[model samples]
Target: MATFAELPDSVLLEVFSYLPVRDRIRISRVCHRWKRLVDDRWLWRHVDLTVYTMRPKVMWHLLRRYMATRLYSLRMGGYLFSGSKAPQLSSALMRALGQKCPNLQRLCLHVADLTTVPIASLPRTLKTLELHSCEISMLWLRKEQDCSVLPLLECIVLDRVPAFQDEHLQGLTRFRALRSLVLGGTYRVTETGLDAGLQELSYLQRLEVLGCTLSADSTLLAVSRHLRDVRKLRLTVRGLSAPGLAVLEGMPALESLCLLGPLVTPEMPSPEEILASCLAMPKLRVLELQGLGWEGQEPEKLLSRGLPHCMVIVRACPKESMDWWM
Candidate 1:
């Protein structure tokens, strides 16, 4: 009779990979061989520590054991309530990660106060960074020692991070390698900063600015002129009037667009106007309208007018529509 423990190390590891982190931890205690196999670096390649209630002691232990090396993608934080301990632990954790995981590429932090993390200490190998409700500045992305801090960084998502302002966007433009950028619930970025910052992102392809001010018209205009390579755009401005939408026509390569927020506001263009503008986009293949309900208008009837080739998705709930990307 072949028991599970009698299986080879490779087969056991393969089985361990499919287990949840908690289950893996429990199984590790069953035997020494299982413990070693469970602790293998390959098992922790894409680690998500957000599932655990992170205290300073627990965080330190996890970093020392599972995240010391060979960590490629890491999603951590949710220790925002740790008060005084957060800064110290976050600083120490970031420093340890920089030393241990030099090849780390993707990082996502949620509700983690990063005020104590030094700008120079950030890992330079990062390609994607997603910050949710984090307190940090764009200064962290600045070049150091004559080299870009995150030279390979391509994608950045700042969701509900009030500290991220227009000046931060200016600093972000330093990363010429950027490909995708998402700014959600960041209200401080105005036209001036957006124009100045966007001009530098010549290679930008996908851009999303949700829950932002109407002043983003200038920003979208800047994107049309500067980022001709952009293929996808998502926006949630208050009033995307016909004139404002004309800017999108300049994007020669645009393929998909999402219009969110109250696009039916009194100041906004009518559904007919919006449909006309979208039809003018020669390359547009998909149009998604979310949370925009107009009186005496059926969303289905509007789509039936034209757009035989483009895919149209209409959703009543804004959040549900955003699930496609966010």
Candidate 2:
């Protein structure tokens, strides 16, 4: 039988890769050979610092020591209670990331304020950026940079961000390479902003707009006319009539659609009419309806009227508390 110490360095490194960051750090103190293997740059390619409550100085030291150039995907920020001082620390860490990790492709910041960070300080190589419940300033979006800020960005998710508004959408038109966008719980963006901003992004393919007050006539009409290449769309319909929902008929390439929120009001069209309008689409493949308030109607019977080629799902909202997206 072979002893553990006689194993090759590659084998040891593979084992260390499966361990969490904290566990790897602890085991790095076991021996000189283990420490060397644990500190290898390949093992630090994806760094997640959200698990610990680290001070600014300690985070800086860790970045400088371990995450200089090999980092590819980074997820930071769990400082929810550190209100006033969080932005400064986040800015420092972001600056360090821009300087050290030029190859980073994906970055997710949860509850980190990004007001003070300069736009130029973000890595130009990033393809996906997810800002969950972070405070952002209008200046951060509109600030002029040297053409390198978010030039190659493909996907951006702004989840429950209060500061995101129509101006931010207008500012995003500079990124012509953007393909996928999610505006969940951004209540400030209106139909005019959505229409004007979306018309400029001719390359956008996937879109999701939830927890916002949007109209099917103005907003969905713009989506139908402008986003001709869209493949998947998720939205919340508040008070759209059956005819208003017909705006989706203009999207020739739409494949999957998700409709959420209270879509069955007395003033709007009936569930049967809405389902008929959806089935009229040429290429629609998947349809999901959730959280609809049809108190007296049988939604299953309404949806079962001969959509043999398409997949349809009709369900009520769950009684238990769950994630907003669910």
Clashes of each: 0, 0
Q: Choose the strongest candidate by TM-score.
A: 1
Off by over 4 Å in 1: 1-20, 30-37, 40-42, 68-70, 86-89, 141-147, 294-298, 301-305, 318-326
| lDDT (Cα, tens digit) per residue for candidate 1, span 1-326 | 88996788888888887776668788989989888988888888887877666567766776777766768998887577766645333555676777888768899998877766765566778899899878874556543333466688899998888777877776776676789999887878887767777777777899998776635466568787788888999887565667888777646789998877654556676667777877778898898877777444476568755787789887664555454234
Which residue pairs come into collision in candidate 1?
Answer: none
lDDT of 2 by residue, 33-143 (tens): 988987899999888877766777877777788877888898887576676555244555677787888888899888876766766677788899988888776676652
TM-score of each: 0.81, 0.79
Best-fitting candidate, scored by lDDT: 2
Residue range with the least summed lDDT across 10 consecutive positions in model 1: 138-147
Question: lDDT score, residue 147, model 2?
Answer: 47
